[model samples]
Target: MKTWKIIVLAAIVVVIDQITKFIVVSTMQIQQQIVVIPNFFSLFFIRNTGAAFSLFEGAQWFFYLTTVIALCLFVYFIKEIGDLNIWTGIGLGMAVGGMFGNFIDRLLFGSVVDFFKFVFGGYNFAIFNVADIGLTVGIGLVVIGLIVSEMKKKKTVAE
Candidate 1:
């Protein structure tokens, strides 16, 4: 993908993530869940006071510290890219935007806005926001890009 296209896609991800967070914060109650389809999915709202999956629950400072470190790594990778492969670009874009998105929430609200929930058979998952989607997709893209690139290299060597 073109550099400009990658930039545009990143901006879109950031905008969508922020807008959804705003709606969730304004419309939903804390821990309030509305089942979207029986028990498989739902829209729930909550402020995550800790890092991923509320791992360090109640430790607000943990989030602040990690966010900075993550943001640093995120930027480091983006800046170091020698060539922009489509999937790699998408990966970096999603990662950078998502990191910034959650960073905004952390700085502004002291927590990340989370509203999507998934559940099944006595098990429930933590709520998440669009930023999480970007983060996840970013990771997936990077992994896939690495795998595909490696395969291409092997094919060329064989030929």
Candidate 2:
């Protein structure tokens, strides 16, 4: 849970996320789909100019501003996150990494590159990328950390 270690973890995530995006952009054409599993999963290239799940379709400026605000919040939270557990640290790192990963795309390309796709029960799931994975999982970890912290506080008060 050291700050440096947390930063390193975030850096790694950003690197991996960017590399995967680079590969996808370089190798795949827009709207291309390569089935990894029939009717289940696939690599489908897409560009999203909106938020997660491609909502709010053309809000470029909105995303740029939000990324800046989120990064600012992350820095403030990190300063307050003393003595947190590894999971919390991982969450912080991943969240920041994911933010940066998507922010990079938004800055350079005006959109995010999405590649992974899933289909379930005749529903075509939204296409996403590594950054989205990191963001979702990271947010989940943060929530878990918060729950654990609350439980500990309640236990102490009860005891």
Candidate 3:
């Protein structure tokens, strides 16, 4: 993947994430619920001051530090790789974009705006946002890429 393409992909994720958040914030009140599918999913407005599932609530400085470190590591990893495959590039782009999306929220509002909610088997799942989706999918893609790369290397060695 080219550097420009990676940047463009990341920018697109950030833009979509921000736009969705803006729409939610502008139209919904805190704790508001808009059901899109009964007994399955809904948009539930809430601000999370911590990590996933609201863990370590209110540790803003810690989050800021960790985010910076992670981003730096990402840059280093990409550079070390020299050339990224499509999956790796797209994965990194989405991951970075998602991180920045939440980081921006933390900087501007002291919390991340989460609204997407899911329920399964009568248990409520963690409420998350677009950024979370990007991060999760991105990481999954990266993992798949790594596995495929390793498999290819092993096959070559055997041959």
Candidate 4:
């Protein structure tokens, strides 16, 4: 992947994530959630009280620590990404974008605006935002890439 392509992808993710959050924050009142889908899905807007699944709720300082660590990881990954691997480029781009998106939210509002909710049976997951989706999707891509690479390695070694 070209360096310019990586830059463009990062910018796109940042714009989309910020715009979506802007809409959510500006339109919806805090703690006042509206369910877009019933049962298995919904949009319940809330300033996340904790990390994913409401972990570490009372520790506001953890947000800063986590964001800094995430930013460092993104920088390291971006610098180390292989030039020809578009998948790696895209994956790192999404991760960086998501990291920054939530970072900005944390800086400005001290919390992220989470609206998407998924549930099944008696188990209920915490509400998440678009940034989390980007991050998760990027992680999925990376895992898939690693699996495919390993398979190819095994095949080559066996040949």
RMSD of 1: 2.0
Residue lDDT tens for model 1, 1-159: 455666677788889999998888788889888888997999988888776678887777776787689877755665676566778888878876787788788889888898889886879877788888898898899788778888898999999
- Which of the two candidates, 2 or 3, achieves a greater lDDT against the reference? 3
Which model, 1 or 4, shows the larger TM-score? 1
> In terms of TM-score, how similar is model 2 to the real structure?
0.95
Colliding residue pairs in candidate 2: none
Estimated TM-score for each candidate: 0.87, 0.95, 0.96, 0.83
Candidates sorted on lDDT, descending:
3, 2, 1, 4
Candidate 1's displacement at residue 128, Å, is 0.7
lDDT of 2 by residue, 52-159 (tens): 777878988888888899889877887886767767778888988888899899889989999999999799988888888888898899888888888889999999
* Colliding residue pairs in candidate 4: none
Compare the candidates by TM-score and give the number of the best one: 3
Report the CA-based lDDT of candidate 2 relative to the real structure.
0.87
**Candidate 4, position 157, lDDT:** 100
Error of 4 at 123 (Å): 3.1
Query: What is the lDDT, from 0 to 100, of the residue 40 in candidate 3?
Result: 98
lDDT of 3 at 120: 98
Q: Lowest lDDT 10-mer window, candidate 3?
A: 1-10
Whole-model lDDT, candidate 3? 0.90
